[model samples]
Target: MRGWRNALMLSLLPVLVSGGLSAAGGPDYPITPVPFTKVRASDGFWAPRLETNRKVTLPANFQKCAETGRISNFAKAAGKMEGKHEGIFFNDSDVFKVAEGAAYTLALSPDPELDAYLDNLIALFAGAQEEDGYLYTARTIDPSRPAPGAGKERWADIKNAHELYNMGHMIEAAVAHHQATGKRQFLDVAVKCADLIDRVFGPGKKYAATGHPELELALAKLYRCTGEKRYLDLAKFFVDQRGNAEHRELYGLYYQDHEPFLQQREAVGHAVRAGYFYSGAADVAALTGNPAYIDAIDRIWENAVTRRMYLTGGIGSKREGEAFGADYELPNATAYCETCAAIANAFWNHRMFLLHGDAKYMDVFERTVYNGYLAGVSLEGDTFFYPNPLSSDGIFPFNHGEPKRSPWFGCSCCPTNVVRFFPSLPGCAYATEKDRIYVGLYFGGTAEVALDGGAVIIAQETRYPWDGAVRLTVTPEHAGEFELRLRIPGWAQGSPVPGDLYTYADPSPAVITL
Candidate 1:
C-alpha cells in the first residue's frame, strides 16, 4: 500500500536511489537527482540500447534462465515442479537482476506481455518462499539436501554463501517491479523475506554481514520503497557491524571488513563489493546525515580515483580472487576489471556526485559509462564480457580464458548486471536542489522537472561524447528565478580524469556557447 508511486513520484522523491537514497532536508547534500521516469531520452545513442535491452535482451536472458534451470528453481522450490536445485548457489541473483531490468523497461514503456510474464514469475517466487517468509531456492528446493553453498542453516555461511546476496537482488527487483507496475505481489515477497532476515540477524540477534556487499544497499531501497524505518535501521546495522570484531569476526580485507569503516582510508578487496558498500554507505549518509558514513566513503572514493582506477574507469587489477591489486599496479592485458565492478564503480560515483554535487564524480561516472562497463555488452546485446581489460592479445585469456565476448558464462553476473544497469540512464541525466536544476549528464531529451514551482520542461539537443555542441531550451512552470548548473566535464578541462593518474595528450580550449 505504501510503496506504489503516483504520477508525481519523481517530483516527490528523487532519482537513482537505486544506488543511494537522495533524501531532502537536513545536513544531507541539497542536490537530488531527477528520476529517469520524469526524463525521456530522445538521443539515439541510449534509445536504441534501451529498446534493444527490452526487446532482444530481456527475452533472451529469460530464455537463458529457462535453459539454465534458474526459472525452474523457483518452481522446484515451491513444489510446483519436481527436481533438485540446479546451477550455483548465486544463480538466483542473475534471475533477479534481469527481472529488475525488465521492471525498468516496463516503467519507460508499457509492455503487457512482459508485465504478465513478471506477474507469473512473481507468483513462482511467492510460492518458493517458506511459510515464515524465508526465500532461497537452493535450500528450499530440498532443505535436508541443501546445495553446495546454501549453508548449514539459513544464515550460517556468510563468506562464500550468497543467501543474503540473492535476497538483496530480490529486494531490489521487487522495488523496481512495484514502482513500475504498482502491484504488491513481488514487493510482498520481498517484505516477507526481509522480515525473516530482520528476525534472524540484527543488533541483539546474529550480528552478521554478507561476504558480498549488496543487501545493505538493497535494504536502503526497501526502506525507500516501503517507508519502513526498520529496513533503513537494518541497512545501517549491517554497515555498522562491518569491522566490529565484538559483533562478528571480520571477513578481512577481501571483503572490505579488515578495519572499522570510519578508519578505512583506502579502497581494498573485491572491486564490486567495495563499490556497493560505499554506495550503500552514501545512501545511509544521505538519509541519516551520519558524518561517519560520509567520511568513510569520501576517503575511500579518493583512494580509488587517485590510485587504483583505470583509464577506462575500471577497477580490480588481479585475476586472483578477481580482486584489486596494489595501488598503481594496474596491469595491461592481465587486468581483471569485471564488468560488474565497472557498474558498481559508476553507481558509486553517481552517489558521490549526488552527495557532493560535484562534476568530478559525474566525470568519472561518464568515463565508466562510455568506456568501462559499456564494453561489457556487445552491439548485438546477446554476447557479454565478464572481465573488461585495457589490452588483449588475439589468443590471450582476457575474460576467464576467452579472448572475445561470450554469449554466456558459467557465472552470469555481468550479463544480468548489464541488463539491470542500462535502464537507469534517464535518472542520471538531471538532478535538482531547492532553487536549481543540475544537468549532471548530457543527452538529447526532454525532462519534466518538479520544482517548488509546478513543472518545468527542459529540452536538451546534442550529439554528446561525439559532438560538443549543446543547445538547451528551458520552460519553467512559472517565471521563477532558479539557477541552472551545467556540468563542465574534467575531460573538457584538459584532465582526462579528476586525479593525476590520467590526462589528455591533445589539449585544446573547451568552447561553450550561451
Candidate 2:
C-alpha cells in the first residue's frame, strides 16, 4: 500500500509541476493573463454570467424579499423599542442591510417593488447602527441590560452571541457594495466595525477567537480588498487561535474546543462553526504560506473526503450539537447539514482547490454544490430548509412532517445564506499560476485571467454539469500561443473516458501535453 501510494504520487507529480492540463491538439499552451470576466447562469450551473448574479443586484433582492414576504423579519426580531435579542443577531442584520441596499440599487429599471422595499430596509439597517460604528440588534450589545438571569442577559449569552458572525457579514456586505458600485458608504461602516473587533480580540485584544466562526474569513477578504496588513495579520491571528488547548477550555467545552483543531484529528463542533473556522484557516494557509497550517488542512480534508463527508459534500454529525461525529457516522435522516454549513464548505473547498490545484477538493465542491446546496432553497430560489436532513420520512419530519420549504425561517440564517452563496458561484471556477491558467470546473461562461507577460481569456459556451462536455474557445489578448491547463475531473477515471478537444481519460491525472 505504501509503495502504491508513493508510485501514485510520483505519477501525479508531473501534472502538478506542469501548469495543469492542456487545451486541444497543439503545443503545451503557455498561460497568459486575461482580465477575469464575470459569468452568467447557463447550461446546468446556477449562473453563467458575471455581474448579473451579484448580491447587491436587483434580482437577488427581489428573490429574497419576495420569498420572505418582506424584510420585516429583522425589525420584528430586533424588537421595535429594544425589547430583547438586540446585538446577538449581528449576522442577520448585516445580511439584511446588504440585501436591501443591493435591491435598492438593482431595481431602478425592472423591479419597482424591490427598489422601494430595499430602500426601507436600508433605512432600517442604517438606523440600527450605533454612532460608535456598532450595528447589532442583539440584547448583548445593549448597555442597559439586566444582570445575568435577571432578564435577557445578552452579554452573558456570549456562547450563542454571533458578534463576530455579524461583523463578518458586514465585511461581506461592504465588499459586495464596493463591487456593485464605486461607493464605500457601507464599506466604511463595515471597516469601522471590523476595527472595533480587532481592538478587542486577537493578540492583545480583550476577547478571543469566536466560537461561532465567520469573522475570520470576512477579515481575510477585507484585507485582500483593502490591502491593509493589519487586517491580514488579524485574520491570521484568529486562525491560529482556534482549537488551541488552553483556549478551547477557556471558551467552553460545548463546541468541542476540548482539543486543538489540528490535534483533534477529526471535524467537530457546530457544523457551520467548524466549516467557517476551516475555511478561515485555509485562507490563512493561502495568504501566509504556512505549510504546517496547510498540512493540518490536508489531514482534516482526508478524513472528511474519505470518511466523514456526505454524498452531497455536507459535513456534520447530527442535529443534537450540530456537530460532527466519528468517521462514517453520517446518518442521513438525522444529519444536521445546515444550509450555511454547506455554503461554507463550498466556499472552503473552492479556496483550497485554488490554492493547491488539487482535483479532490473540486470533487468535494461539486458534491456540495449539487446536492446539499440545492436543498437549501426551493427550486424557485425562495424558501429554505435550515437543517438539510438527508432522509425525510414521517418520523424525521419535514417542514412539519414532510420535506417542505419556507420563504423565511424563524432563526433565518439559512434562507439569506443560500441567496448569498448561490449568486457568487462564478467566482469559484478557475484560477491562475505563474503564466498558466487552469480550468478547475466545468461550468458555462468565460474565464478571463491575467497571467504570464500578457492577458488571455477562455470563452466557454457550453452546457456543463448536466453534461460532461464543455466547449472552450481560447482568445489571446496578445495573440500568442499560451498554455491553458484543464482539470481532468477525478470522476472521469474510467477507461475510454470522454476523450475530446476539451477532455481526456488520464487515469494517472496526466498533465495535458497539448
Candidate 3:
C-alpha cells in the first residue's frame, strides 16, 4: 500500500505541479476575499493557533482517525486490509475533513512528509472507489453489511445514508489538496467521485437531495475548480429539490426539507444543517446572481442573527435534533451549542459577507471566533469542548451530554472542525473590491492585497480583542486614490448589533468610534 503511493507521488510530482486551475468566471459578487495565502497573520492570538494547528492539531487529528478506525475503513474497502468497517458511517467525513485541514496547513508551510502521507491516503481512497466512482467505505467494504442507515442498495436511504455528505467532504478536501500542492493525483479521484454523483442525481435523474446540507458547497467548489457547468447545475438541483414532494416524501424541516429552499424565510430545524444550507445558498446566489436565491438567504440571515443566534454567535438551542428551537428558546443551563454548529455559523457568516460586503456579517463571525467557536478547542489544541454552554454547574452534563472538554468523541466532527477552521484565520482578516480593500477582521498582520486599483501592502499593529487600539500603514504600488473600509465591531459602535437581540450597559462612560 505504502510502496504504490510512494511511487505514485514520485511519478506525478513533475508533470502536474502547476499552481492550480484558474477560477472559472461567473456572475461573482462584488466582494472578494483576499486568500489566506496573501495575508500573513502575526497576532499573538491567531498566529499561534495557525502554528499550533500545523505542529500539533493536524497530526493529532490524523492519529485519532487511525485509532478510531476512520483511516482503516478506507484500507479495508480498498482491499489492502482484512477487517469490517469501523465506527459510524459518517466516520469517513472525519478523515476527509482532517485531510482538508492538512491541505490548509500545507498551503501555509509545505511539509514533504505530510504531503506524502496524504498521497498514501488518497491512494487508498482511489483504490476503494468502484469502477463507476462509488466511494463510501461503509457500503463498499461489504454491501451486505452496510451501515444501519446506509440501506443495502447504494443511496437507498438518501435521507439518512449520508452518502452524499461523505462525498461532499471528500471533494472539498481534494480541491484543497490540489490547490495547496498543485498535484492532480487527489484531484483526479475527486473528479471521478463528483462525476459519478452528478450522473446519479439531477433534474431528470433521481431529483433527490441529501439529508445533510453539505454537497451544495462542495459542488460549488468543484464547479469553480474545473469550470464545469454540470456541477453547478447539480448543486442548484439539490437546493431546488428540497421540499419538492413531487417524486418523494420530504425529509421535513429537520433536514431543511420542509419547503422549497427559496420560499423558506425564517431559520428553522437543525442548526448545522441550516448553517451549511444557508452558506451553500449564498454560493449559488453569488455564482448565478439569482435574485430569488439572494433574497431568500437575506431573509434567512436576518432570522439567524436576529432571532436564532446566541450572544456568543453560537446557534441552535435545542438538543433534541441538535437543532434550533423557537425564537428566544435559549436556556442557559440546558444550551446545546454544538461546536460544529458554531464552525458552520462562522462559515455561513463569511459567505454572507462575501455576498453583501457587510461588516455586520464579520461582526458575528468575530464573536463566534472569540466565544462560541473558540471554546470548542482547548489552548493546547488536543482536548475539545463539543458544546459551548454559557455556564456549567458540573452536574448537568452540559457539554454535549459530556464534560466541557474531551480529547475525542465517537462523532469526532468538532475536533476535526477545529483543525480545519483555525488554519483559515488569515482568510478572514481581509477582503477586496474593484478599487478598494476592506478589513473584515482586525489582526496584527501584513497583507499583500491584490485589487483592481493595484497591488497594496497593509501593515497593522494592534492587541484588538484583548485591547482596542489599532494602527494601520498602507502603501500602494503607485500613488493613487482608493477606498479602504475598516469594519467596526457593533459593540464598539454602541449598537452591539443591528437588532435588539443583545445589549450592553456600563456605569462608566467610554468613547468609541468606527
The prediction achieving the highest lDDT against the true structure is: 1
Instruction: For candidate 2, report its TM-score.
Output: 0.78
Per-residue error (Å), model 1, residue 38:
1.4
Better of 1 and 2 by lDDT: 1
Ranking by lDDT: 1, 3, 2
Better of 2 and 3 by lDDT: 3
**TM-score (all chains, Cα) for each model:** 0.94, 0.78, 0.94
State each model's CA lDDT, in order: 0.85, 0.59, 0.83
lDDT string, candidate 2, 11-122, tens digits: 2323342322222222121221122224433554555222333433335544555454334434643344434432224435435544734532342123555445544655
Residues 292-342, model 1: lDDT tens digits: 888889988998999999999999988887888888989988888899999
Candidate 1: list runs displaced more than 4 Å.
1-29, 506-509
